[model samples]
Target: MAIISWREQMSLNYPPLDSEHQAFMKVINQASEDIKKRHIEGMEKMFQACYDYVRNHFSHEEDIMERIHYPEMEEHIASHQLFIKNISQFRQEFETADTVGKKLDASQKAMAFLSVWFLGHLISRDKPMKPYLVRLRNLPPRMNY
Candidate 1:
């Protein structure tokens, strides 16, 4: 079973952002499955992939927020930074466990953290951007003569 599943309610009504979010969910779901199977290698690989994707997605979002001059851009960027830091810490812990040849339940921890954070962010943080995005989308196209 996937830890998180995308639904209509989660949609921000922004296609690019929504697509990226869906991809994030899919990666986490795959990671959760790998964890259940005790596929350490696969789990680690997926974790790295997830981390990379998140960094890229965050950058992309920051760019949009910048372009839109989002009122809460600072707070949103801070949240993204905090998330990256947390994930980095988890990655270090996973590496330490690997080095010591101890079976650490890092995968479970990672899944739990990501699932909760993603949901909360989607609802609380991302939700606010909907109106702004809608307004942007509704703008008339510029035509150059």
Candidate 2:
């Protein structure tokens, strides 16, 4: 599994939000590496943490989106739902695997899925929302996540 690489392109020109995004990527990357190393138990905990982080992050982002009257809020949240679905699928695979070996085997593709989803979303879909977000937010929104 490949680690999610953060770069300038990932920056939405919003420092606070971008920082949270970076942390999200960090958690995902750690989980990916753990899975790749066949650290099954570590991987499981990290993956759970990743899911929790994503949900909290999305909630905070959505709140900002709503407060700022972000027009694409629904679509953005829909994207979040897709990520959660992917997370659930991986969790299911991890849970159903009869052996640590099977878990690791299944983890490879799941990590890849997460890497691709994160890179694509942050660079393409999420990045495009920044301008409107900047205009709407006007200031850093309160962060509860």
Candidate 1 ranges beyond 4 A from true positions: 99-104, 138-145
Q: Which run of 10 residues does model 1 get worst, by summed lDDT?
A: 98-107
- TM-scores for all candidates: the values are 0.87, 0.84
List per-prediction Cα lDDT, in the order shown.
Answer: 0.80, 0.78
* Tens digit of per-residue lDDT, candidate 1, span 1-145: 8889889999989998999999888888888788777788877886788678777888988877876778988999898888888888778778778542343476677778988998998888787888888656655664659
Give me the runs in candidate 2 sitting further than 4 Å from their true place: 136-145
Q: Tell me, by TM-score, which candidate is best.
A: 1
Among the numbered candidates, top lDDT falls to 1
- lDDT value for candidate 2? 0.78
Span of ten consecutive residues with least summed lDDT in model 2: 134-143
lDDT of 2 by residue, 1-145 (tens): 4367778878888887898988878877787778756788777776777677677878878877878787778888899888888878887888899998878866776777877887888876678778887675366755677
